[model samples]
Each structure stands twice: as C-alpha cells, then as structure tokens.
Target: MKKQNSLFARKPAKSPKSKASMDYPETLEIIGLSHEARGIAKHNGKTIFVTGALTGETVRYEISKKHRRFDEAECVEVITPSPNRVEPFCQYYGQCGGCDLQHLEHSEQIKAKESLVLDQLQRLGKFNPESTTPPLSGSDQEYRRSCRIGINQLMRDGTPIIGFRRRGSSKLLQVDNCPILINPINKILGKLKAVLSEADSCKEITHAELSMGDQQGAMTLRIKKPLPESLSSSLQKLAEDNEFRLYFDNGQQINAFGDEADLSYQLEKSETQIGFKPGDFIQVNASVNTQMINRAMDWLDLKDNDRVLDLFSGVGNFSLPLATKAGSVIGVEGVEDMVQRAQNNAKQAGLNNCEFYRADLSKDLKALPWYKQGFSKILIDPPRTGALEVIKQLEQHQCDQILYVSCNPSALARDGAELIRQGYKASKFCVMDMFPHTSHVESLVLFEK
Candidate 1:
C-alpha cells in the first residue's frame, strides 16, 4: 500500500446518501431569524434555514433544498412555538407567496424588519446610525392599494385560476380573496375570477394588475395576444359593472377599453393629487406611502431658500411635495415617459417652480444640465439596487442634506457606507412598514454633511 502524504491526505470518507435519504425529517432548535424571515437552525454543524419556524422555537423540519454551505427546510411540525407566533388571518397564508411573515405576529414582524435593516448596515457597511427613530407603520391588513394577480388555466379543467404564486413554486395558488388587499380589490377578485372562467379567451391573459387610487380604480390585463371582440366587450362590461377603468396590454402598447378618468391619489399634507396611468409604478400601501412622504419632508427640513434635487423621481411623488416648500425643485428621472408625467403632474398641480428632467442616473451626472444648477438638498429614491453611483457624486454637489429612501436593506447598507466615506454622517434612520408581513424592508436615512 502506498503511504499517504499527510499534507494532501483526505480524511476517511463517510457513507454517501441519496438526495431523498438526506432529506429525512430532522429536529432542530431555532436560534434566530434571517433577513428573509426564515428561522435559523443548525444540523450536523451546518446552517439550516427553516421556513415557518420562529426564533427560539423547537421544530421538526424537512430539507427542501440542499446546498453546499447551507440547507433550506420547510417546517413540518412545531415542537414548541415562540410567543411571537400568531395565527395568520388569511385563508391562503401558507400557500400564497405574496406574504412571508404572516406566521409571525404583526408587531413582531415590524421589529424583525427593523432589526434586519440595522443588521445589514453593520454586517455589510460596517457602520451604524447615530440614532434611530421609532418605526413608522400603518394598518397590518387591508392596507395594500395595488396588486398583480397571476392568471393561469387549471390543468385538470380549463377553468381560470387566479391569485398569487404558490410559495417557492411557479404554480399558481387559487386565492379568491386576500386579506392584505384593500376591501375594494378583494371584493372584486371572486367576481373577476368568475368572469374569466366563463370567457373563452381567458387563457390569452397572463396576469392582471389591479390598482386603487383615492377616487378611482384601474385594472390592466396583460395578454399574449389581442382578445377577440366578444372577449374585449365582456371585459369592458365587467370593468363598467365594477366601476373601474379597464385596459389591455399586448406586450407593445396599452389600449383602453372605455373612457374613464385617470387614477389619482391624494397627498393631503401637500394638497396634491398625483394622477397616474394603470401601468405606472405607485406604492402598494397608500397610507404608508403618505406617511413616508410626510416623514421625508420633515426629515429634510425644507426651507424657502432651499433648492431641492429629487433623483429617480417618479411621477413627482416627492418633487411636487418638495416644490411646495422649497425655493425651486428639479426632478431627474431615467424614463422619458416618467419625466413627461412628472412635468404634467407639476403643471397640473400649478407648481411653476418644479422642473422635471430625463437623465441616466447610473452614469456620471456632472454633464447633466440640471447638475450645473446645484442643489442645497438632495432626495434619492432609487430602485432596489440602491444609489451607490449617486452617493459617489454627492461630495461634488456639496449638498447640506441627503435623504435616501431604500426598499432593499443590503443595497442601502452598501451605499450608506459610501456616503460615510464621503464625510457625511447618518443622522436619522427609521424603518417603514410599507410592506407588512413581508421580509421587504423600506427605510429612510438622513445624511447631513
């Protein structure tokens, strides 16, 4: 037998098990919760993530996915439940992928999200806020103003199945009602499903987006191809009966069925009504959106002489409000259509001081015409990717204040560190419960130079 070299020697190999055998049910002691709201546990010295398991609870779980470093599990039975665990009110809570933290109590859900933000800041950015404000939250249920309902035809029967996706799967979960949606949207779900099930061309639809504004509602159906005249008329009749605007989108352009007023939401504090088309991006939670805008305004401490720059501005959500208080406001957006919409919104709001510009924010913005004007304060509401590029250019602007609105905590933490490196100090940080019972963390950070 050849002598083994200790330097390159392999340890005694353990018996290999098949995938099915490796997934045998195992008991674990939940130790913590991940940023995604899954419970953390240890099995054979490896980390296991258990869904539907609360921290500090003993649970029986089965591995759903095995990875090299960690394993993902689905909680099969709760040996002991945490005090913070609560009964999810929605009938389709476990099945629907729309919500992740419904099993966790509402208040505890907020706490977990708050903790997630702070943890990400420390772990990724290696920085902490000077101070944190109390979390801003609204009603836990019936708070969602907009939602996209997935549509698919049942394999067994040709009937339409409507609702969100099943958890961790591409399959559709038939949900006639969702508790998180506002009453109006929930009330129409069953009726809409019934109508679609009866229509011969319902299979042409991929999904339907429902949006509710303060005064009106709109529904947009995404179709693979044009619907027949009969199907179009039936959908229009349904929209009329439901008192909502109806539109069909066939990959290229959106076409309205009947003449209905545009959808608009009220920002009572600023006395502004923002009108948007059905496909336009709007906050899903209306109340939380209002509160978030109010908080942003207060945190920025706008002054009559201040010139505000709102980056990633969408439909003048913050620009119009800032314009109402600042000397002059310049809104820059990447999408030309959104810039036009923002301009129209400003014009309709009768705010002559507000101007909207179209620019690619990811690239160096120094050459932009609006950059030469300079701003005393800047508000950034970039998408989930965060505003690292914008944060890098802030030192050149020499703005006194920078208010960042983030929907993704990891991205926020990364950019927050960049701001600190530029000599700005994080003054106030607060988590917003814009999406309750979900792992999504929305937050505001005020950085003062």
Candidate 2:
C-alpha cells in the first residue's frame, strides 16, 4: 500500500490567543488546491482549505475561526505569487464576487479547465481523451447575460444590497456595478438596484434573471413570495422609468414583449441572425459559443445522410445547425417553452428537417417517444449536472459518434466512465475558457463506438 504523504496530514490548529493574531495572518505556502477557492497546505498529510490562497499562491489569511483540522478567513497578504496569477481586469473584481478567477490569465484558465478534464478522464473514467478531438473554446467576457442574481432586502444596519454571492460563501455580495458583465445588463443592474433602494412596496426582493436575445432582453423577477397587484404596477413603472422590459415571476410568470431587435452571430465565416429573449439561456459568451459549435461540427465530421439526435438541445442550438447539413435532426429538451421556441427558431431559419421534443431528459430517456430512433450522431449540452441518464441511453443505443458539451467535469467524468465501460471511447476533448477569473470550466468531448 502507498504511504499517505505528510503534506495531506491535518495540522493541529493553534488557539486564537491574541487579537493581533486575528488581524495579522500567518503567512503560509499554498501547495495543492482545494476543490474551491481554498488551497491546501499541510503540516502532515491532513488537509485544510488555505483561506485566501489560490493553487500555487503563497498568502497569509487571518484565521477568524479554527477547528482541529481546518482554518478559515479572508486572504490578507500575498507573500509569494503563483505563476498563474494575473492582474484583475475589473475594478470591482474581487469585491463583486461574480467571478472568482479574475486574477488568472485567459490561457491559464483554459489550461486549468483542460487539466481538470484530463484528470477526470484518466482517474474517474479510466480512459484518456488526450487526442480524440480539438478543444472547444469561447470568449471570456460578456458571455453571461442570463443569471439569477440575489438581493439582500435590508442589511442588518438597514442598508440595502443587491448582486451576486460573496466569494467562498453564501452571503450576498453588495455592489451596484459589475464590470465583468455586459454593459447593457450591467446598466439594468445599476438602475434596478437604485430603484429598489427607494421603492416603498419593495421592502425586500430576491434577485432577477436577465437574459439577452439577439436584439432584446428578457427579464424575470423571482420574488420571495406572492406580491400585491399594486406591486406589479410598481414594476411596470420601474420598467418604463428605465426604458427596459421587465417581467415578474411571483411563483408564476407574466410574459411581456419588447420591441423587436435583430441579433447576428458568426459561424464559420457565415453570420447567422438571431432574435432572442433576455431570460432565455443564450450562451453567455455568444462569440465563443459559435466557435465551440464550429469545433464540435468539425469533430463530428458529419455526412449528408447522417441523422443527428441532440439531447438537452436548447432552441435548436445544435439541432437546427446540424439540420443544415444532415438528412434529419431531432432535438430533445425538458422545457416545453424551449422546445416550442426551438421549433419556431427552426422555422425562422427555414430548416424543415429538424424536430424538437419536450421531455425531462434528467430522468429516464427510455420514456421519451424518440428514444429508440437510433440516430447516427448525438450531441448533449446538459446543465451543470452533465448527462447521466442520457449518457446511459446513448451507451445502450450505441450511436456512431457523440459530442458532449459540459460545464461540470465531475459529472462528465461520472458519465464518461459509463461510456468507456459500454464500448464507447472518448477520443479527444478540450476545455474552453468560456468564463474567465472564475472556477467554472466548459468542456467538450467526442466519444465513438
């Protein structure tokens, strides 16, 4: 048996003796990385989250609280630098907490994410995708427009705060301006915060989901509870006051339309026009999504007669595009609205061979009417959970080729194991830095039977 390394052994936490000790953090070297922002430094082999430390960074953190095995606090001083460190671009970068990795360079972020995929493929899946396909990639900034931001109704001191969660915590980060976001949505965020600060009916409010369409934005309000009719009037007034369309969702939805705007996207030197809603799950980095899709298509190596099945396909994102080249395409989605929107998008695109079906893809795929279609090509773009059931079904079906786009690698690895076990092989994959300055990594893998 391999001996446990002393670096991973937990160090005995010292008592909080002096107040000065709390303010002046003990400088420590960061060795290994914790799953999150916390890094690991060990006296023995026992592990703890080196508060305020990034992987390879050496820093000191004021230990606010300590236990037998771990210590926690905000990062205080940088004793030494990590090779991966970069100056943050956003002025309010660290304070905003919208992105955790603003301190790393773009290329480093991609490499880190790719490394994660390689780790998962080797360790969890017990296979390698070191050479299968070219990596998927996208832009780093302004890629996120659809997000559910939280708002603190009133601070303990009666002040108000609204925005994303704090770094390494569930507490909300208070800020009026978020520089990492797209300008238009950031404007809405500022205005909305200002408006909520004064609204009489809105004593406390949760965050809102803002999505950008090709030309307009779709906004949804996720209130804490059922609001009064007068409150609805207030929301409308707020919208008119700011010149932006806003929708309210008090456990239910009240849809509203915005003035039509045209949006154009580039794909393989071709610019495709799109009309979208602010609340729809448009890829955060639109330009990067185009590149990612292009790479996926290249990896697919499609044929004119190939029949493609797109799982977790949102609004014909991949399905419709495949239809442009393939014989027929089927898109499966859990949301009826998204499914219908995909159909509309296909019609608008003048693609007749694509079809969209509404089904709970997270559940069993066998229940879906289209499960047994036996498609020649398959693509999955699931949420953070990745595609477990869908992967299982694919293994059972044994499609000729599959392209899986994922945001979470752990889940991807879990499913990848099934694919390898069932005769499918992960040939190649790359991590795209869709989000920079944060821990999130987007991945793409091509598996073949």
Candidate 3:
C-alpha cells in the first residue's frame, strides 16, 4: 500500500458518536424560559432547554445533553427572531456565563422577570398580590459596582485566561473587558491583566474580586500561597498606579496594600455610609439597590413611633435607613462580623436609634433576645434559600406590616405560602432589574397582617 501517515492520521476517522448525534440540528419554537434563563421548547413531547434562544423565537439548536424526559441544546441559528431580541453588546455574550439575557431587549427582560415573579408566586405560594407596582429599573449596562472574575492558571501561549467561566462548562474565556462593570472597573482590566501576567505569583491566583465604593475601588487576589517579594512589589505598584486597593488572600488571612482603607458606599436617601472589607457581601447594582431600599422604606410607611425589625440585614443597608424614620430599628443578621459592622456603621452615622444583633436566622429563633420584641413593622432581605424558619414565627411577633426582599422567586414563593398561612395577605409587589443582563429576579412584596 502507499505510505500511510502516522497511526492517528492513518484514516480520516468518523466524527465522535456524541458529536455526530449533536450535528443533526433541530428547529425549535421557544415558548418560555427555564429557571436558569434557558429557552424552553417542546419537541415530540420532549421538553428541550435551549440556550441563546429567546421566547417567541424559532431557532435551530444542537443537543448538548440528552436526558430521559428533557434535552439541553445550544441555539445554532435564529430562524425567526423575536421582536424583543436584540444584538448582544458583549462579544462573549453566548459564551460567557456572566450574562444570559443580553440578547433580549432590556425592557422585555424586566417584564419577563416580573412575569416570572408573579407566576412563581401563583404556582408555588398559591397567593397573588393585590397590585403589582411598576418595576424599579435603571441603566441597562455598566451598573455593577461589585463583581467576581475567575483566573485560569493554565497557560495558553504563555498567557492565562482571566474572566468568567464559560456557559455550562468550567472552561475560562479570556475577556479584554466586561461592559456590565462600571467605567472605572473596565478602565483597569487591561492594566490589571498585564500586572497579573507579569507577576511571578500569577499562577497561584485562583480568582480576583472587585467592589467599587463611591470614591475608591477594592481588588483582591485570592491566591494559593503568599506572593514572593518581587510579585508583591509589582502588585503594590499596580495598585498605586491604578488607584485601587489591592489585597492578597493566602487562604489563612488577607493582607491589604494600597490607599483603599476608607471604602464605603453611601445611601443617599438616608445619608448613611456603610463600610465593608474586601470580601464582604454587598449589592452589585448601586442605583437599583438604593431605589429598592427607598421603596421598602416607603412601603413600610415608617412613623416616628413605629419600631422596625430588619431580618437578615447586611451592614445596616436597610436598618440604618429605617432608623432614620422609625422610633428604633433592631437589625438581626446571621453573620457576627456583619452585625458588628452594622453596629459600627450605625454608630458612625450618629444614629443611636439602630442596634444590630447577630443571630443565625436559618436556625431556631425562640431563644434569641430580639425574638420577643414586638415591632410595628418588619423588613426581611433573605438570601436565595429564603427565611422559612423566620416566617414560621411571624405569627408570634404580630407585626402589622412586613416587606420581604428576595433575589429568588421560587424561594420567595415558598416563603410567601407560609406568610399567607400565618394570616398575612400580599398587598403590593415590585420587581427590580438589579442584575440587568441576567435572569436574577429581585422582587419585593409587602404583606399586611
């Protein structure tokens, strides 16, 4: 026979079986969105979840995962695009997991989120609000003040990818810049990448985090070990050059180096500034967060004589504001550090009316000192899992009004069901686009006893 190439190239082998199966694309009509923002389609009685496909659009999709009752797909072609669809601004739109609804119109995205909240409340909570207020929304882009980015130590052409994980995969995609971040953050990415690349300790970095306060920004390098002298000096110079607070977390403790110590975000409505460390949890979208907090306060209709209780309160974001209007505000948080920070913030603001106590809200509250306090109104801003145990004891407190802020609709619905059972009726509901291009739904509901 004629000379054959190496064994690997001996034959132009057939495509892998899984690849071949996915190569056969199917046309699908998207009708709804899954909880993860994937488009939902029905094909031959099997439900297909499609990424990059908008509702009311027909698209050609390739199967990525096939299960017994459902299949997962990635949209290949938009055969019929929805009117609400628009070209994505980011070049890495479909690939980056940071944003999912960038292709959909911003207005439509908020509407869809509002619809999702209402639908979940109806289905899971078996309750509906008496009225749905207009959604609180702001700029569709460049609104995030807090962000986290992953760093891939694996070298590609002697350079690592610094950005976010790819959609449905652990692989990292290198992004020059992210549009959702504020202008200051975007301005530093190029310089930040260069600094990381040149640093000898770059390979040890697991991720980078940034949070912008009103005057300054903080960046943290989560590393596997302490950086060498040379790398630390380089990072310090980079922070000084870019006017950012930089830190290195070597698993045990974090060491800061830069002029970022006075970092605080001011709540204009209440005129209170909340200080936080590099890794503390805070709201991402400043505008939406302020508006939402103001809305909650308005809904509570605080009076000088009304005592307010804030549950799951973080650094007095809502409690400090509530203290300005209510007789006294008692904030309960699960994290002791956060509770201490909230107390300090209240003290700094010269607001002696607000007090914070640490309590594991996810656990039983029967023995907690604040558990017995009867407040005229209450506010709860729970995490994704919601506050089931806290809601269960609401009947014992007998608060007249309660405003619940939730980032997950399903969790809110489950908690809402319990609230209704405890003799509370949903009154006003509001949704906000806290995360512009993502399916994250931030909703607030007011319940009256």
Candidate 4:
C-alpha cells in the first residue's frame, strides 16, 4: 500500500464532528467592524476575533489562532465604550449574544451602516452618480420580531441551557433578556435563566429557536439530557412566570411543545397577524423589517397587476405585505416550517394573493417548480452568502426590477456584480441600522434590469 501523505496523516480521515471551542485573545481593542457581525482588532499587525466586544471598547479576549495575516480572538470583556455608546435594555445584553449593537446609539448605528453599504456599492458596482444613490435610513431599534437561540446542555451541572451561541462558536452563551427581541420574549429571560440554572441534567445542549407567533412568543429548548417527567410542570411554571410557552426538544417533545406554545406578530400599519414557531426564522428587528419591506416595495414600484417574487422569504415578512399591493406575490424559502408558517400567516391575514413554496435557493434553483414564471419585481433577501444562483434565475426570468436586502456586504457585492453581468444597473442603495453599538450594517439596494 502507498504511504499516506503527511498532510493527510496530520488531518483527520474525516472532519471532526465537533467545532473547536476557542478563547479570544486575553487583550484586545475595539478596532472596527466589517458590517456588524464581526469585530476587527489588530495585535502587532496581526488580527484577532474578539467575541463579545464593541468598537472603542477596550476588552480582554482569548486568542484562538494565529494566521499569516491575522489572529482570531473572542471577546471576554468590554472595558470602555466609545463616546457614542448607550445603555442596553435587554438584561441578557452581553450573555445572550443575539444583539451586539445594543450599546451604541441606534441612530448613529444607522449612519455608520449606511456608510458601509455605500462603500460596498461603490467598490463593487463602481457607481458614483447621486441620481442612482438615495439616502437610506429608517427605524433603528426594537426591530427584531423573530429570532433564534441555540438550545443545549449546561456545563458539568444539570443546568438546562437555552439561548444564543457564544461569541465565536456553537458554545451556548448564558443569556437573560434580549435587547433586540420582542418585549414578550425579553420579559421571560430571567425566569428562563433561573429555570435552566436548576436543571441538573442539562449538560450538552445545542440550540434553541425563539419565534414570535401571531399573538404570543414561543421558546424551544434543545437539551442534551432527557427531559424530566415534570417537563410540563416546569414549563407551565415558566410560562406562567414569564408569559411565554416553554418547548422541549428530543424525540418526545414534538406535540408537548407545539400544543403549548404559540407566537404572533402585528403587521406594520395593519391588523395582519403572523404566527410563528420556534424553528421559524423571523427578522430580528420586527420594526426594521416593516420599513425594509416598505422600502423594497417602493423601489420595485409594484403595479396593481405586477407579479413579485420574494426569494428566501421567511415568515412572509415581505411577501405578506407586498401581497397587499401587488396583484400576486410568491415567496420561496428553504425551510418547510417557515414556508408553512408563511402560508398560515397569509391565511390568518386573509391574504389569498400571497403564496409560499419551500426549496433550497442556495444551489441550482432551476429545478424549483414555481421558478418557471417570469416576475415583474424580484426581491432577494439572502444570508451572508447572498443570492448568486437566485440572481441567475431572476436573469433567466428577465426580471426588470430588483430589490436586494443584504446583511453581508462582501457577498452582496459579489451578487451585485452578477446582476451587473445580467444587464441590471445598481440604481439606488441605502443602509438601515438594524444593529447598534456593533459594526453591523443592513443594506437595501434597488437595481434596474
């Protein structure tokens, strides 16, 4: 047999199942942010990933590794805030790890975010005319109508765990009230913390999904240990105490959790009700979502008979609202649960004109059945990866108007280039500050085909 290569020998035959837990560098400074999710700090001309840090705040972190270009570090402290800092509302502000920009002024956060978006558009689209650029700023706080939290086991103790991932990895972060989540969810943080603190069997938790339903909020705990027989009682107490349903994961939990929990959201400027589940992906800032949808619709200039397509549609956020104006609105999503929720929400809102389909839009989207139709307006809301293939599909449909909502600038730029390749001009770009105190930016771009 041939000898194994040194590189192959050093590497595992198979990828490690578990992610590496890392400590941020013990010492670091708040340098800046690319958008908002990541923090930038350089040490001795090296870079570090400082988990749990804000710009201008001197902090301590543990170094994860050293690369030829930069080092990765996770946050451990928040020494000081920049002059533009503000107090955080959520009790779980730091520990929850859901909202990092809570410490900065929400308005200032928008200005910074707008700068980032404009910078990216110029860099990628290479546009400079003011006619194609519009000043974009809108609601900057209390925008999260939907959010997700990881549910996992506690440490050595039996503590039940629920909340966002740690600063840098899958490790669960201990959290209380989330600053950016709905008041209904944030209100239950303390009770949740206390409950999990008492669960001795909680040791190897993974993820928790928090969702806002049509009338209330729901919490799903993904625990590593077997749920106790008193799971209902514990959850009942928690719900009574916090006014939100408690859901347990594992093979036995499907009904017990769903039957007890229901989440809801009030549509902006309307009485439309949206129901969501723990696993459903909703916008973190409900308020901003409304503005975003409004802006996208405005940019698309939907006519009464226009057909609109919303890719990566979650909970019918844009699709539901857009349906109110357009002749027909179609939403495409990857998660079936979210698709169902969107459909249910449409039914509840009495919105028959809106439809949702579930399919993976990340890869080749040509196989999707609903994708056969051409659209007058296309709204793409993709994750950090942005909508590359989806953009291609839109090109295939010969869409004339495109509104792109992006959270990642680099990916947005890449996809923007693809749109340019397809003869779409970046007509207007603006930024929405969904996150404050952190270097994150939410951007909206309108392109003409």
Candidate 5:
C-alpha cells in the first residue's frame, strides 16, 4: 500500500493564540490561468490558485483548501482589477459552478480560450497546428437551449432549491433565473419552482432537465418515486399553460404530455431539421452549433465523391449535414437509442445516402464492417475521453482527412499525438464559443495525410 505524504496533510484549525500565525486574506498578484480557469499566483515561494481572479490582477483572497506545494483560495476583493474585468450579469455567478468566466469580458474570454488550446496542444502533443482559423462565436447571453437543474434539500426557510451545484460542492444554489439560459427556458424557472416546491413529489424528484427548440420547450423530471396522478396532472397543466412539453421518469417508466410539436432544431445550411427527445445529447448553444456545423463542412471541403464517417455521432447532428455533399456517410454511435434516432433523423431529412450504426468506439474496430469501408473524410466528436481507439485504426482504414470537434483540449492533444504518429498533420485549428462564460473550450481541428 502507498503511504500518504505528510506534506499534503490537512493542517488543524488554529487556536486563539496561534490564529495570528495563519495565512489568509493574503494579497497576491495573478500571473496566469490554471486549466480550470482559476488564476495562478506565487506567494511565499509557494504557488497559490485563486478563484475569481484574472491574469495580471492583484486580489485579496482567503485560503479555502490547503495543499502541500500549492493552496486554493477564494477572491474576497479585487484590490487591482484587470482592464478586461467586467461585471457579471448573473446574480449567482460567484456561487454557481456553471459559468466560471462570467467576470471576464467576453472578448478576453475568447483570447484566453485560444491560449489555453494552444498551450495544451504544445505541451501535450508537442506540435503546433499549421494554421489557426478565426474562432466561431455567437451571443454571449441567453444562448443555452438546454440545462439540467439539480433538485436537492430545501433551505431552512422550507423552500426547495432548483439550480446548479455550488462551486466545488454538492450543495445546490437556488436561482430565480439564469442569464445564460434562453428566454423561454428562463421564464419557466419561477413557475417550475413554485409548482415543484409545493408538490407532494418534490422530494421524489432528483433533478429536472430543461430543453428548448426553436419553436417549443420540454422538461423531463427524473423521479425516484412515482408521482401522484394529481401532481402529474398539475405538472401537465403547467406545461400546457406555458406552451411546453413535460415528461416524468420514475425508476421503471417514463410518461409524457403536451408533445404536440416535435422538439427539434433546423440546420439552415443543409435545410434539415433534427428531432430529439428531452434527454438526448443536443448541443446547448443552438446558434453556435449551427455555425460549428457550417464551419465543419467548410473545413472538410467536401467533394461529391467523398465517403465520410461520423464517429460518436449524436442524433445525426453532423451526419445529415455531411450527407448534403458527401456521396455516402456513415454515422456510428455508442448508444442504441441514439443510433435509432440518427437513422430516423436522416430518413426524415430525405438523406438516403446516410446510414447509422451502433458500436462501442472505445474498443478495437479493425474487423467491423464500417472499418473495412474506405472513407475519404472522417469527423469525430467524442466526449472528453476522446476517440483514441478509433484514431489508432485510421491509418489501417486508409482515411485521407480527419476533422475533430473537441470539448476537451487535453484529450484532443493526446489523440492528436496518436494521429501524428499515424502520419497525419493538423492543417487547421479553430475555437468555438459553444459555451460562453464557462471554462469549457470547444475546438475544431482538420488533419490530412
């Protein structure tokens, strides 16, 4: 067994006499940002990481978590604020973990994200992209079309909190409205709180997912216990009054109501619309997502003879669009439901050239039928873990070009190194503001042999 190091052990709380010996409310000058977007500083020869601090700013912060070589602190006052600093519009900005960069100017946030991606690529992959494309951007506020709000214990005043988790904690922070959510979704939070807090099913619901399309909104409740019929009827009425769809999921079954309209969004470039269930994995920022797909098509420079493969394809977000130019497109997803949904979406879009398949992409796919097929272009949009196994076989499949839509820079870098080893050179790279005011960075890269 490995022994715990003493240097990193927690220090006991100080007694009255030794309270003066403690280091807190310490003044520090931030020099950089950590991967989590926290400000980095050095004080007393030991590194200190400060939350809510920006680069080149001096802040007064108190230690929140102690460590061996570094300590974590929360900014109490910004004695010297950066010129890029701006007032956060969200009332719960500091407490909510959903939006970390809300205090920074939106333009500055883009610059920081570009730097972060470049740093990760150089440090982890040891290579620079041939060229950097201008970032794809969109509205900074009220852009989130989908969000999952936590339902946890009520406050001392007996009001339940329905919002995001607090920073670095499991506690839920009650929010009346979120500035980042679309207006339609934000408008429903108050009524949702009122109905949910007073319902007998209040404690039974673990969380609620809110999603909105261009024309309609939907909410899904993940309930641990069966809701009373009366309460379910009330929720249905609430959905009808607000012109939204509602669904409830107990441990065993799901019930839905007021689903007159297909919860869907249109891809203007392809003239295709995609329908998704409440729990499907649709991109939260619709405006940026459309731009991203358009950018992906441009970067791929698709030819009519092209045969493309879309890996980790979710509900045909990219497949149907790629089919617009490619001769044939194959979309592979891990989840069976998503595979079915993708096929349905492609069929609805009148895209006969596209097909969907369910496969576990994390494992070897050398013998798979799709693996045997030759692809002129490939698009991968894996989760944070990335598509290492799939990239490892790209050379064997004789793929000519590869485009990656990355949500995690580190994972992209790791997989990029593998692609480089397979004789692929990154030709273009660009960042996307898919998630504004958050540390999350979305990037796109194009590679060719």
Candidate 6:
C-alpha cells in the first residue's frame, strides 16, 4: 500500500495561541483558480482560497474566514504578477461586486471560463466531450442590455443610494456609471440619480429594473407605496427625455406612466421579435445571444419536417426561431404569463405552427399532453438549477438530438451525466461568454444518440 505523505497527515488540534496567529498575512504561490475565479493555494496540508489573486503568481493574503476543510483569504499584495494581468478599467472594479475578472486580460478570461466548464464536466460529470469548438464571445464591455440597480433609501444622508451591492457586503455601492451597461442606460444614470435625490417619494423606492431592446429602452421602478403625482411627472419627463418607457410596480400591478411601449429584442438571423416585460428574464448579452441561437439552429440542422420541443422557453425566444425552420415547435415554460407572452409573440410573428404550454418541469411531466408527442429534437435552457428532472424524463421520447444551454456548470454536469447514462454521447461543446468579466459560466452542449 502507498504510504500517505506527512504533509497531508491529520495534525493535532491547535492551541488558542496558534489559532490567533493564523490571522497574520502569509505568502504563497497561487497554483490554480477556483470556479469563482479565486486563487488556490495550499499551506500546511490545508487548502487556501485567496481572492483577487491569479495563478502562477506569489501573493500575500490575509485570512478572512477559516473553515474546517479550507481557509478563505483576500490577497493584500502581489509579490509577482502574471503577464496576463491587466489594469482594470472600471473605477469601481475592486469595490463593486458586479465583475470578477476585470483585472485579467479579456482573452485570458475566455480561456478561464472554458477551462472551468471543461473541469466541471470532467470532475463532476465524469465524462469528456468528443470535441470543443471555439468559444462564442462578443464585446466584453457595454454589452449588458439589462440590469437591476439596487436602492438604499437610508444611506448617504437621506439621499437614495443607487447602484449595485458592494463586494462581499450587503451595503450598496453608489456608482455614477457602469461600463458593462449599454451606452444609453449608462448615459442616463446620473440624470436618474439626480431626479431621485430631489423626489419626495424617493424613500419609498426600493430598486429599479432596466432593460433595453433593439428599438427601445424600458425602466420599471419597484416601490413600497404609490408615488406622488409630482414624482411621477418628473419620472415621466425623464423617461420622455431619455426616449425610454417608464413603469411603476407597487407589489401588485405594473402601471405605465404615459403610453404603453412595446419592449422587445430582435433575433436577426431568424428575423424574429421577442417581447418581454420588465422583470421577465432575458439574456443581457445581445450579441452572444444572437450567436448562441444561430449556432443552435445550425447544430440541430433543423429540417422542414422536424418536430422540436423547447423546454423552459421564455417569451418564445427560441421557440419562435425554431418554428421558422421546423415543421412544428412546442414551447414549455413554468410561468403562465410567459406562456401567454410566448403565444402572443408567436401570433405576432405569424408562426401558427408554434405553441406554448405552462408546465412545472421539476415535477412529473409524463401526464402532460405534450409528452405524448414524438419530438425529433429537444432544446433545454434551464435555470441555474439545471434540468436533471427533465433530462431524466426525456428517456421516454427517444430524441435524436438534444441541445442544452446552461448558465450553471455544476448543474449542467449533473444533468449531462444523466443524459450520458441514457445512451446519449456529447458531440459538440462550447462555452458562451454571456456575462463578461464575471465568474458566471454559460455553455452549450449537443448530445446525439
């Protein structure tokens, strides 16, 4: 039998003095990066995860929190920096929790995400793809079409603090502009902040959801109470001046200020328009989303007689596009409003072959009427929790092809393993840079029988 190394041997419990000394700064070489983009190091047989550090660099980190299996730390100083490190452009790069890989070069960031996805598949799924295509990426800045801005009414001397949350804290970090947001939204941030500062009902405001479509922009403010007429007029004027639609939600119904403007994005390849409400989920990266959909269509090799089943379809984002090529397309979503919205979108697109249904995908779906159909191709864009339950149920359909778009790699790996067990082989795999500068991983995998 192989003897265990003393370096990894279990050590006796440390005294109170030794435990206190652990708070001191320690220097170590960063050997790897965690899924969250933190540096990985080992000290005295215990693993250490250091934030703000990169691989192949020597860093001095201070322990922030200690755990039984490992220690958490924050890099205070870099003794040696890697060549891939770049100066972050955003002024609030380190202070804001919106981005994680701003300091790393953009190309290196893509490679890291791809590596992370592959690592998850191998380590968690216990499988490897036959081939990995080049990663799908777009502009790393000013690409976010939507954002949720936090509001702290109690902060900054009664003036509403508007921005994202601070790094590792619930406290709000006031930001004048975020580079990742689209140019129009960034341009109006200061103006909006000024308007809120002067408004009497600003304290009643909680947060704001901003979304930009191909032709128009929309903002929805979540409020605790009804806004006064004066504040409402000011907001309406602001939206008019900015050429964006404004709406107010008081935890019940959403009311528009002036005319109800249609908020929708265009899928250029398919020539399809998808309309969505303010709080509805849509891909923030427009370029990547277009590319992702186009690639999915190409990978599926849609035929005129193909019957496609789109799971977790949102506002017919994919179902409408698929209907343009396939003979028939069925969309299943968990939200009733989204199902209705999708049906309306399909009707507006003049695609009668596409249908939308509301179903709880996590529960047993065998009893659903749509389950009886023999689908030739299946596409699932599940949430971060993934589609393990749906994948398990798919075995009864004998689908010829399955395309999965995932935002969470761990969940994808768990579901991918199930698909593999059901006699599906992963043929094509690629990472999508959906959220640039962040540790979030979005990927696409095509499985074939």
Write candidate 6's Cα lDDT for 289-355 as tens digits: 9999989998999999999999999898889989999999999999998999999999989999998
List candidate 2 segments past 4 Å from native. Answer: 1-27, 62-74, 132-139, 155-159, 224-243, 257-279, 362-369
Top candidate by TM-score: 6
TM-score of each: 0.93, 0.84, 0.92, 0.75, 0.92, 0.94
Query: Which pairs clash inside model 1?
Result: none
Indicate the TM-score of model 4: 0.75
lDDT of 3 by residue, 1-449 (tens): 22111111111123234534554435778999877788999866788888778898887656666779887777767778788877778887777878888888999998888988899999988999999999999998899987888887665555766888876668888888888999877766666678777755477778888778888777788988777888777877766565577888877777786455567999865568988878778998899988998898889888999989899988888888889889999999888888889999999999999888888887888887777768899898999898988888777887899899999999999999998998899999999899998988899999998
Candidate that beats the other on TM-score, 3 or 4, i.e. the better one: 3
Residue ranges of candidate 3 with Cα displaced over 4 Å: 1-25, 258-260
Identify the runs in model 4 with alpha carbons over 4 angstroms from their true place: 1-33, 36-66, 70-105, 128-173, 197-200, 204-207, 251-253, 363-369
Give the distance in Å from residue 46's predicted Cα in candidate 3 to where it truly belongs: 2.4
**All candidates in order of lDDT, best leading:** 6, 1, 5, 3, 2, 4
Clash numbers, per candidate: 0, 24, 0, 51, 0, 0
- Alpha-carbon RMSD to native, per candidate: 7.8, 6.0, 6.3, 9.4, 5.9, 6.0
Cα TM-score of candidate 1: 0.93
lDDT of 5 at 79: 75
lDDT of 3: 0.82
Pairs in clash, predicted candidate 6: none
* Per-residue lDDT of candidate 2, residues 1-449 (tens digit): 22112211222245456536444335566775543545666544545565446677666554556667765544556667777666776666655556666666777666666766787778877788848444555556766755677867663545567788864468887767766567667777777766665555454356678666554555567776655666566655665554456676655664553332233233445534444544456677776778787887788888889989988887676776678778889998887877877888788788888888988876777766677777898898999877887677676677898888888888888888888888888887877767766777788888887
Q: Give the TM-score of candidate 5.
A: 0.92
> Candidate 1 overall Cα lDDT vs. reference?
0.84
lDDT of each: 0.84, 0.68, 0.82, 0.67, 0.83, 0.86
